[model samples]
Target: MIVMDSKAQLTVDIIAKVAEHKMTIVNAAKLLNKSRRTIERYLQQYLKVGIQFVVHRNTGKAPVNKTPDSLKRQVQALIKEKYFDVNLLHLAELLEVNEHILVKRETLRSWAHNIHHVKRAKRRRAKARKRRERMESPGLLLQMDGSPHRWFGDKKSCLIAMIDDATSEVHAEFFPSETTVGCLKVMRDCIESKGLFKALYVDRAGIFGGPKRCNFSQMQRACEELGIEIIFANSPQGKGRVERAFNTFQDRLVPELRLNNIKDMASANAYLKHVFIPQFWQSQIQVKAKDRASEFTPLPTHINLDDICVIKEHRKIRNDHTFSYGNKLYLIDSPLKYSIANQKIEVRNTSKKGFTAYFAARRLQVSEVVETSKFDTEELEIQKKLDVLALAEKLGNISEASRLSGVSRDTIYRHLKLVKEGGADALKRQETPNLRHKNCVDLDVEKTVINFSLEHPHLGQQKVALQLNARYGLDISPNGVRGIWLREKMNTTALRVEKSLSLLKTA
Candidate 1:
C-alpha cells in the first residue's frame, strides 16, 4: 500500500499492461520513454519482484557528495567567531590554507548565506582616467605609500611599502604610526639593497616637503643627496600602482599574518623580509619588466647612507672647543690645530650615534659639558651692585664711579638718592621688620647667633644651637638658629660665605 512517486507508478502500470498483452513492448517503451530492450528488461524485473521492484532500493537516502553537518556548523561558528567581516572567497581560502578545511568557495558561500549576514568582498570604485604604462625597466621608478590597517588583529598599524613600477617587486614593513622615519627606512632599504633608483613616485605628504610642509623635509633632502628624482603625485590615483597593491595586501596579507600569529612589528617585519616577500610575493606577484636590465645605479663606495639619512644642522664652535647643541653645552674631546672658534660645524642626530659634529665630513669627538648652575652667578650680580656703590662712596665722585663700576648714570643716581634718604643700612637689601612685635630677639643674642653661624657654617643648625648653648649658655633652639639665618638670607654655607664676602667688600 506504499504510494510510489509518479515515475515509479508509471513504470509499474506500463509493465503490468505489457504482461497482460494490453500493449506491445514498443508502445509500452514509448509511454515510459524507454527502448524495446528496456521495456523487456522491466517486464522481467516485474515478474521477479512485482510492484516492490518499481521503488528504488536507495530511496530516502542522502547524496554521497552532501556536506557534513558538523563541518557546516564549524564553518558557521568560525565565521561568527574569528572570520567575521571576511568575504566568502577569502574565508574559503583562509580555511584551506590556515585552518586546513577543504571547503570550496561556492559551498562556503552557500553555507554563509544562511548565517546572519554574508560577508562580501569590498567593491572598489573604478576610477576612469587615462591609463599610463609602466616604467620601461626595473629601478626606473619606485612608488611608495603607507597603508593603515589592522593587520595584527585589533591593533592598527601602518605598513610602509615601496613597489617597483616596472617589475612590481615590493619591500614593506609595519610601523606603529606613519612618520618620516618610517618612510625613510622603507626607502633606505630599497636604496641599500638594490642601489639608487632613477626616480621616486609618491603622494604630496608633508613628509615629502609638499604644500603642507613649511620647509624642505628630510625625505626630500635625502633624495636630493642621493641624486634620486622625486615626482610628487597630484592625486592618489596618479600613483595607482602602490595604492592598488596596498588594497590587495589588506585583503590577502592580513589573513596570512593572522594565521601565522604575527602580532608585533618586529615579527611582522621579519616575516615580510625573509619569508613572505621572497618566497610567496616574488614568486607569485612580480612580473618581468619591458627591459630586463635594471636602471638602478650601483651604490658608490664613498656614499655612506648612515650619514646621509640623519638630522643635520649647523652649530658654531666656541673658543674653548665647545658648542651648544639641543640647548646643552658639549666640549670637543681633543684640541684643534686651526682656528675652530666661530667656525661652522654640522651636527647630526641619529639613534646609533646620539649627537655627532662634523667639519666637512670629518667627525669631531665630543662629550656633554656640565655647565655650572646660575645659582653660583646670581650672587655675583648682587655683589656687582654693592661694589659699584662702594666705589662711589670711596671716590666721592658720582661721574667717576659711573665710569669705573660700569653702572649706568641713572642707576648710580638712584642708589645715591636711596643712600641720602636713609643710612648705609637702607643700602643693604633687607626686609622691613614687624615693628608691632616689640618682643623681638635681643640684639646681642641675634648678633652672637649670626657670628657663630658664619664661623661654624660647616656645622648644621642643631650642632650650632648646641654649641651656642654650651659655650655662651644661650637657650635658643635649633629652629631658632635656622629662623635667624633665614632672616639674614644666610641659610646655606655658600650663601653665608657670599654674604660675609659682600660685607667685607663694603667695609
Candidate 2:
C-alpha cells in the first residue's frame, strides 16, 4: 500500500497515466511542475515497486539531527527539578550554561509543553512604550529601585537593586524593609563590586529627595560627597529599566526561591549572590555594551565607605571634650591636641557600626557615658515620664498622646493627676515609685539595654533580649524589655516618627 500526501498521490496518478501512454510525459511533467526526466524516473519507480514506490523512501524515518530520548528525559527532569518556575528562554539559557545542553528557547518550550503539559497564557496587550537607547558603556548610569515582594514565602521583603543602564547588569540585596540605609547598602555593594558609577538614576522617593520643602536628602548628601550625581526621574516610566528588571525578578526569582525552599532573607540573599546572579548573568537578561570600557571610577585610598555612607549630625563639643546625641552622652577618649571644645563636630552613625565623631575632617575617639547607679536611672525615668505627659497635654487628647508616645492610658491619667496637684513642675520633680515588679531588671542592666539599643538601633526586641542574655547574663523576656527605650524617646521607630513630623512641618 502507498502512503503519500495529496500532492504526491496526484503526481503518482499522473505518472502512472503517462506510463500507460494515456498522457504525454511532457504534459505530466508540466502538471507536476517537473522536468520530463523526473516524470520518467517516477514512472519507472512506480512500475518497479508497485504502489509503495509513490511514497518517499525516508517518509517515516526520524531526521538525522533529532534530539535524543535520553537528552529529552534529562531536559524534562531538569525542568521539573531546578527550572520549574523559570520561563522557557531563561530555562534554555540555564541549561546551556549549567547543564551544557544547548537548545533553542522555542524548541525547549515545545518539548516542555509536550512532555510536562506546561502552558503559558497569552499576555494582555499593553500600550506601546517608547524605545530608550542603552548607554554607550557600562557604569555610565545606574538605575536603582526597591521592589517590595514576598520573595521567599509569607514574609514580604524589599529587594533593593541597582542595574547598569548600558549592560543591564544588576546588584541587589534583600532588606526586611526599604529605607535609606537599604538603598545606601545596595549602592555601596555595587560600588564595591563594580567600582563607582558616574551617576545614579532613581525615583523621587523621600529617601532620595526629602519631603517637597527640603533641599536635600541623606542620599543626595552622600552622593555629593562621593562625587556621584543623583538624577531623580520625573516618573516611574522614566526609570523603566529598573522597573522592568524588577518585574522579571518577581516572575522568575520568586519561583526559583520557592523551588529551592528558601524562606528567609539571609538564605535568599546567599543564593542570590552565589547561584542565581551568576546564572542570570550567563542568561539573556544582560546585554553587552558597545564599548567594553567601564565608566566607573576607582575609589581613592583615603575615602572610607563607612564614613561616607552614614547619617550625619552636627554636635557642639563640650569644654570637657564631651557631646550628647539622642540624649546619650559621649566623652572623647583622649585630650585633643588642639581643643575642639564648644566647636561643632560631625557625628556619623551607621547601622552596622555604632557612632564616630569627626572634627575638621579628623576622626575622634569617643566612649559612651554609662550610668552605674540606680538613682540616676530612676531620676531619668521620672524626667522621661514627665516629658511624655507634657507631649500628651500639648496634643490635647490622652489616647492620641499615649499612642504617639507609647505610654499607657492609665499611666497618662496618673501623670495627669500629679500635674493637676502641683503643675508641670511637680510632674518634672516627681519621685520614683518605691516598689517595682519582679520582672524589672537592675538599673545598671536597664542602662546597658539603652546603650545597646542606641549603638544598634536596628536591633528588634527579640534580638535585644538575646543580646542581653548573651553578653550580660541577664535573662529578660522581649516584652518585659520592649518599651524601656520608648520611655526615654530612644527607640528608632519613635525617632523615625519624629523625623517624619519634622519633615512634614518643614514641607
Candidate 3:
C-alpha cells in the first residue's frame, strides 16, 4: 500500500522484517549497504511512526534551496514569450542577469523538459575530436567562416563572421551570398574596429586560398598585402569555435529575426551587430582571458586600408591611358599620364569607392568614360556576349553557367540566340517590352511548387504541374514547373540516382 519508488519500498520491507525479528539488524545493514546505526535508526522510526516512517524524512517536501513555484513559472513564461529560441545554458545566464532569477543550466533544462516538454533532436555522433587550446590573448588568431542559412524566412543568406580565438568575440555581416567582397567587407569592419589581428584561421574555400596549386585568391592576396598570415583549417573540427558560433546563430538568430520582422540582409546585419551580439556577450558565453591586454596591432600610418582591402586586378593601360574593366573603359589621368602609357597598372575596385588605378605604389586619378562611340559599344557588347558564351562552353552546360554567373538559363539562351542571329551586337540591342504576357503565378505559388517538390520528391515535372493545377486551381505548364525546380536546384532524379548508387556501393 506504500506509494513509493522501488528503493523506498525495499527499505520499508527491510524495516518491517527487522522489526518482526525475521531479519537481524547486522544482516539488514549488509543487505541495504548501510551502517548498523542507520538500520537501527530506520527500525526505531518504524516503531514510532508505523510503515510510513520507513520513507525518507525529506519525502513530499521541497528542499530549503528549491526555487519557488512562482519564480519557476515566471522563468517558464519569460522563456516561452521572449527567450524561446535561447539554449538552456544561455537561458540560465539570461535569467540570472536580466530577470534576477538565479538558476543552474541543469535545473533549467530539467524544468523546461518536465514543465514545457521542450526537446531538442539528438545530433549524430561525430568522430572523436582533439580539442585545440585557445590563444592566450585577443587578436593572436581570428577564426573566420561563412554560414549559408535561411536567416530570413523569405530567402537564404550567407553570414561571413570572424571570432577572436581567445575571447570568442564575434563580428559578422550578412551577405546575399558568400563572396570575396563579403569576406573583405567583414574583415575590413573587424580590423577598422578592433585593429589588425596577427593571423586569420579560415577554411580553404575558393574565396579564401582555394586549392593549394592555384594562385592566391583576392582575399588571400589582400591578407598577404596587409601582413596577415592565413592559416587554413585541415578539417571543420579544427575551427570548432567559429563553427559552434554558427550553430548558435542557426538556433537563436533565425527566431530573433522572425520576432523582429527582419526580412532583408541590411536589417539582419544591423540587428546582429547592434542587438544580438551585445546581448550575447552580456550573457557571459565568452570566457575572458587572464591577460586583458589585446594583441591586435594598430594600423600603420603608411598603410591605406582601402588599397589593401580592395579587389585588385592587373590591366595594361592603353596608349590613350584608358583601361577596360567589366566591359567599360576607364581613363586614367595623372601628372605623368603620358609617361604611364602602355604600362601595366593595377585596378583597385571597392564596394564603397568605385575604382582607382595604381602603378608602382602610386595612385592615379581614374574616371569612367560616359561617352562611347557606336563602334566601341558594338565591339564591347560583342566581346561581352562572346565571354558569356565562352564560359558556358567551358562548363559544357547552361546550368553551370547560370550557377556561376547568377544568370537565368532563359537569359543565356536568349543571348546565345542573339549571337546566332545578329552576332554579338544583337546582344547589346535593347529588348522590346512584352506588354501582353504577365506572370500567371505569384511568389506564394512559387513557394508552393518548391514545397510540393520537396515533399513529393519523386514526382516529375508533369505530375507536379498536374498536382498544382488540381490543388491550387492554377494551370501551369510542365516546363514552368521544371524551371521552378531547376531554380531551386531540386533535381530529384539525379539525387535519387546518386543515393541509389551510394547504397549499392555500401552493399
Candidate 4:
C-alpha cells in the first residue's frame, strides 16, 4: 500500500490508473520515470479519499519570532521625520539602541513595508557610459554644485558647495541663487584658501558656461588670470563625484544640523568650519595623495588672498577728513589729521557688514558719527531705485514705461527722480552682473577627442592622435591634444595612476 498528501491527488490519479489496471509497481515507476516507492506512496493516497486529504505536508511549524511591533513603529517614525536616506542596517542599529529593542534583521525587514507604509525612494545610480575616466592628483581638480535646500534648518537659504574630487573636502557658502555670482564666490574662496587648482571641473550649466558663445565671459577671464583651467563635463555623469557627495551630505548632514539646532546660515557655516568638517573628512574620505607628503601646499606670501578674493574700489578722503563708500560718508580719525582730503585710499567690501579701509597697509579708523547730507541722501535713493529696476529687468520682465532698454520697473522707480533730473544715462553707469568666467574650446578638437575617448578610454597619446587623424579631420599630434587636455585638468584621473605607480616604486 502507498500513501501521499491528498493535495497531490493529481499525481496519485495517474498512479491509481496503473494500480487499478493491476500493473506492477515497476511498470508504473518506468512509465512516470519515478522511483517504484514514490509511485506506491501516491497509490496509497488515492485510496484514503474521505477526510484529511488536501493538507500541505509542512504547514504546522510556527514562523520564527518577528521583530517587535513597538520597535518597527519607532523606526518608521524616525524615517518619517528624520534620516530618510539611511539604509536598513543603520536603521536597525538605531532602533536597537534608541528604541531599546533587540530584533533580528530578517524579522525587521519582513515588517518594513507594513511599518513604513511606503517603499524607500530609490537612489540614483550613475549609469556606465562611454567616456574617458578622468581624474587628477589631490588639490588638482575641484568639482562644484549648488544645493537649494534649507541647509540652516530654518527653511531660510540655499547653499552652493564645492568639493575636492581627490579628498571629498567641501567649501560651501549660502547664496540667494545658483547664479554665476554664487559660483564665483565659492571659486574665489577656494582659490584664496588653497591656491590655484590645476583646473576646475563643473557642469555645463548656464552659470558655468554662457550660451556657448565664441567669446570668453568675464568670469572666465578672471579664472584665466589666475592660471586656473575651467573644464565642463560633457554630461552630469562626468561630474558624478560631486553629485554623489551631495546625496550623502543630504543623508548625514540633516541630522547633524538638527543635533546642533542650526537655524541660520551663519551658525551653520560656523558649525561646518569648526565641528562638522574635521570629523567628516577624518571619517569618510580616502587619502589619494601621491605619498607621505601633504597634498595641499600653502598659498604664496606675496599674494594677498584677501585682496584677490574681495571686491574693492579706490577712493579719496574728502575735505572734511571723510570718505564715501556706497553713499555713506565715513569720517576718518587720523592721529596726524590736519587734512588728508583727496588722498587715495582702498575700500574692501565683503558679503558681511563692516567694510575695511586702508591706505598702503595702514588701517584708518572710521568715525562712528552719522553725517547727513542732502546730495548723499538723494544719491542713495537713486541707487536703490536703480538696483530694484535692474533686478526686475534681469528676470526678463518689463518696466512701467514702454521701452526696450531692458530696465526693470524698480529701476524706473529708483531712478524716477534721476531720469527726471538727467536721462537714461543717469541710470547707465554700466550695470555688470559680477560675472567672472566663460567656457572656451576648439569645437573640432573637442569632438575628435571625445569620440576617441568613447571608443578607447585608456588610449595613449599616440593611439588617440592616430585615431583623430584617421577618423576625424584633425591632423594634430597626439602630444598636442594630450598637453591641452592635461593643461585643462580634464585628464587628471589617468595621471593619478602614473603618480601612484611612482609613489609605489619609491616606497
Candidate 5:
C-alpha cells in the first residue's frame, strides 16, 4: 500500500465523487486545477489502476541533475577551511582553477546560505548624488584611490591603484604608506604603460590637492605639468568606479595573497603586476570600452618626467648665496651668475637628480656647507640624565619610571643616587659607557646586523632583534641593535633605506 500526498488524495476523492455523481467532471477539473481532458484521463486511470494510479510513476525517483553528496561535502569542507572569508563569486572561480571543483557561484551561495548561514548582500541605496556614466573611451577619464587594508598579512598596507573609467583596466601596487610619492608613482606607472590619461578623478585626500587650499600640491604640480586635469570628487559616489574596484579587490586579493604566501610589499606588488592584474583582473573582470578607440595621448618625446614628478619647495637665496634644506645649509656653487641673491627659487628633490635648485626652469649647481659644532656633546648626556631623574621623581618609582625611556635600570639607579647627592655637577658623569664603551661586538655580528638593516629597513629595532634572536642564535638586545644602527648612521628607517638603495642596486 502506498500513501498518497494531499494532491493525489484530493484527486482520488474527486474521481470517487464524480463516480457517485456528487460532483460534475467540470467541477472536479476546476477544483483540481486541470483541464476537463486531464480529469477524464484521471478517472479512467482510477478505474484501471485503482488507488495506485493516484501516485505518479516518477515520484520516488531522484532528480537527474541532483548534486552528489560527496561533491557537496568536499565543497563545504573547502568553504569552511580555505574560503571562509572569500567572496562567493571569486570562491567559485578559485575552486574550479585551484581545487578542480567546478560549481556555479549561485549554487555555492545557496549552499553557503543554508550551511554557513551567510546572508546574501543587499543592494545599497543610491546616495544623494545620482549615479554617473562611465567615460566613452579609456584614458578619457581615470579614477585613482588608495585603500589601506590588511591585503596580505596582519600588518596594514596601502594599495594605490588607478582604474580606467571606460575599460575598468586596473594598475596598482602595494605601498607601506599612502603618500604623495605613492600617488605619483601609481599615476606615472599607469600613464607610462597606457599613455597619458586625459583626466584623473580622486577623492579629497591630502595626498591629492585637497589639503593645499589655494596652493598646488606635488600631485597637482605633476598633473599640471603633464597636461592632465585633476578632478576632485565631492563624494565617494562621485568616483564610484575605483571605489567599487577597491571593494572587489578587498574581497578577492586578500585570499589570493594568503593562499600564495605573499607577505612583503615587494612580493605583493609583483604578484599584483604579473599575476593578479593579468590572470585574474584582465582575463575575467575588465570590461571593454563603449568606444573602442583609446583617448590616451602619447607621452611627449622631449618631456622630462624627472623634473615634472618630484617634491618641490620654494626657498629664498640669502646674500651669502646659501639656502638651508633639511637643517643643512646648501651653497649655490660660486661662478658669479649675476647677483641672484634674495630671489626665490624652487628646490626640487627627485630620484634621478637627488637635491637640485631650479631658477625658473634652469638648474642651479649647489654645494653643502658643513659647519663645525659649537656646542659640547655633554649637553645631550646632561639632558638624558635630567630625563631619567625627572621620570623617577614623577612616578616615585625607579623601575617603572625609566621603563619606556629606553634607559637601563642600573643607569636610572645611578642617576637617582647622583641627584640625591646634591653635588655641584652631580648630573655631569665622568663618561657614559654605552655599547661603544662596552666591548665591541664581533666584526661578523656587526656585519650581520648591517645586512639585516639593509634587507628590512622598515622593521623596528625590537622586531629586528627578535627576528635575529629567533632565526640565528644572536645574543643582542634591542638597545644593542639600536647602538649598531647609530654607529652605522642607519638609526632611522628612511635613512637606512635611502643610504643603502644605491649599495643595494649596485650589488
Candidate 6:
C-alpha cells in the first residue's frame, strides 16, 4: 500500500485524484476519508490549475500582509552602508533588535539575493570532476602531510599527520615545527605502532623529494634504507582527502584547542594522544573489518620502536680507547686495561644528543665524548641565522631590522617590506674582495714588465694601457699586475710587495 506520513501531501493527492476523476469535493472526501472543509480546500486548489469551479479560495491571498518593498530597500541599504559583511542570521537578528523590524528567514534570504544582483555576484566556477576512488588495503598506502596550524590557541604549530589509507587513523603527535626530523619521528612512530605501510604519499616538499634539477635528496635516501616506497602528489587536488580533513580540523580542532586551553605542541600532543584520537575514532570513523566480519588483525606488538628511530653507525675503537663517530671521538671504558684500537664497535645516535655505544646490540659505557671540528662555512651561516632568528623572535623590532647593522630606518623598512615573505635568513651578507691569478712561462719578460711598472709611479696605468697589445708577445695590460698586487696585499703581512718580489732575480 502507498503511504505518506504527511497529511498535507495526502490531501493534495486526494485533490489531484478528485480533479482527475471530474468529481465534486463532497464525493472526493467520502472516498478519501477527509473532512468536508478539507475537501473544499482541496477542490479550491484543484480548480486554480484551470479546473474552473474547483479553484482555491486562498489562491491569490496576500502573503501575511507582505514585507513592504520600502522596508526591504531600507534593510538592504542599511546592510550596504553599515553591515555589508554581516552574515544573514546576524543581520536578521540586528533588524529585529535595532529597527523593531521582524523578518522571516526566507525574506532575509531574499534580501541577500537582491544584494547579489546589485553587487554583480561573482560567477560560480564549474566544480572539478569527481575522481574514481581506488581502494587500497590497510597498511598499504599511508598519506603523510604536515598541517601547519594553530594546534594550540596561543601559538601556531605543525602536526605531522600519517593516516592509514584504509582506516584514516592518525599515527602521531603535534610537532613544534614542520621539519624533516619531525616527519622522521612521526614515520618511525607509525612503523613501530602500525607496522610499515606499503607506500607513503606526500607532497613535493624537500623533506620528501627534490626539484627536477637535483638528484634524490637526503630524505629519499633515508626512505630507501627503511624499505618504504615514496609517492609524491603533483598538485593539492591529488591529495584531497587530507586537504578536506584539514578543513574539518580548522573548524573543530581550533575550538577543541580553545576548550582544552592548549597553549603549546606538547599539550596539544597530549590531547591528541590521550583524548581526541579515541573520541574521534568512535564518532567519525567507519572501518570495514577483516573479511566482512567485525574483526581486525591487531597490530604487531614485538616491534621495538627505538631501534628504527635512531641513526646507527659502525666504528672502530682506537688504541687511545677512543672511537670515531662521523669523525667525532668518544672514549669507551672497556674493562680490559689495554686499548681495543682497530677493534670494531658500534655507535648509535638515539633521540638524545649523546652517543650510545653498543657492542653487538648490548649497551657499553663511554668514558668521554668529543666531536671533531670541521670547516663548514654554510653550517656556521645556518647556525648564525638560527640564533639571529631566535633573537628576532624575542625582540618585537625584528621586522624593522636590516642585514647591515644599524641600517637607516627608511632602508630597513624598505628591505623589510621587500623581504616580508622572506625569513630572517634572507637578510645575510656575503664576503667580498674577490681575486684571480694567471701564469705564463716567460720569467724574463714577466720580470721586465713587472720591474718597469714598479719603477714608474704615475705612468704604471698608462704604460699598462699601452702595453695591452705588446707585452712579451702577449695581449696583457699593466693594470693586471697592479690588480694582482693590490689583491695579494689584502691577505699578506708583507709591508711592501715590490721589496718581497725583489728577491726573485730576473732569469
Which candidate number would show the highest TM-score if scored against the true structure?
5
Candidate 2 worst ten-residue window by lDDT: 495-504
Compared with the true structure, what per-residue lDDT tens digits does model 5 show for residues 1-507?
A: 798778778889999898778999999989999999998998888888887777878888998998898888888888888788787777888898999888876778888876864635558777476667878998899999999998988899899999999989998988888988888888888878889888999987777877554556899889998999999988888888898889888888888999998888889988889988898899877999899999998899988777777788999999989999888899987476487889998988875657788887878888899899865877788877787778878888877876768788888877767877974268775665543544788878888988988899999999999999999889999998999999889999999989789796887
TM-scores, in order shown? 0.61, 0.59, 0.60, 0.51, 0.70, 0.44
Q: How accurate is candidate 2 locally (lDDT)?
A: 0.82
Q: Rank the candidates by lDDT, best first.
A: 5, 1, 3, 2, 4, 6
Residue-level lDDT tens digits of model 4 in 1-507: 335565356555566666578677887788677897877666666567632333445557655764456766776677677645455665566566566766677766665666554335467875778764434466777888787776655564666778877666678777666866567788877776776677778766665555574435544655665667788888777888787776666666666677557777777777776766676644655455443333455666776645545555679887777877877768887675355678888886666655788887787778655756465665675565566556555755454332555455554655666766786557645456443224434666765675455446577777778877787667777667676567544465465455445556897
Candidate 5 global lDDT: 0.85
Q: Indicate whether candidate 2 or candidate 5 has the larger lDDT.
A: 5
Give the alpha carbon lDDT tens digit for every residue of 1-507 in model 6: 223456546566667777687677787778778798977765775677533333345666877878889998988888777556455655676678667888898888888787783323246775676684634467766778888886666667887777765666767567777776778788877765656666778888877775741646545655676667888887776776666667556545665666556787677778777776787644575365243321123434664545545555678777777876655566777576555678787665655776678876667888647456785887686565555544454665654443434445564454455347665555555464342123532455445554555544335444654764464555455555555446435212242444445645652
- Residue 301, candidate 4: alpha-carbon lDDT: 74
Better of 1 and 5 by TM-score: 5
Clash number for each model: 0, 0, 0, 13, 0, 6
Predictions in order: lDDT:
0.85, 0.82, 0.83, 0.65, 0.85, 0.63
> Per-residue CA lDDT of candidate 3, range 50-76, in tens?
888856669789899988888778888
Model 1, 36-144: lDDT tens digits are: 9988888998899888878777877998999999999998999888887577777877788768999977788888888865855568987789999999899999999
Q: Better model by TM-score, 1 or 4?
A: 1
Span of ten consecutive residues with least summed lDDT in model 6:
289-298
How many clashing residue pairs, candidate 6? 6
Candidate 2: clashing pairs of residues: none
For model 2, the stretches where C-alpha displacement exceeds 4 angstroms are 1-5, 59-74, 77-82, 93-107, 115-130, 192-196, 210-215, 247-264, 274-295, 300-303, 313-347, 356-507
RMSD to true structure for each model, in Å: 15.2, 18.1, 16.7, 27.1, 16.7, 21.5
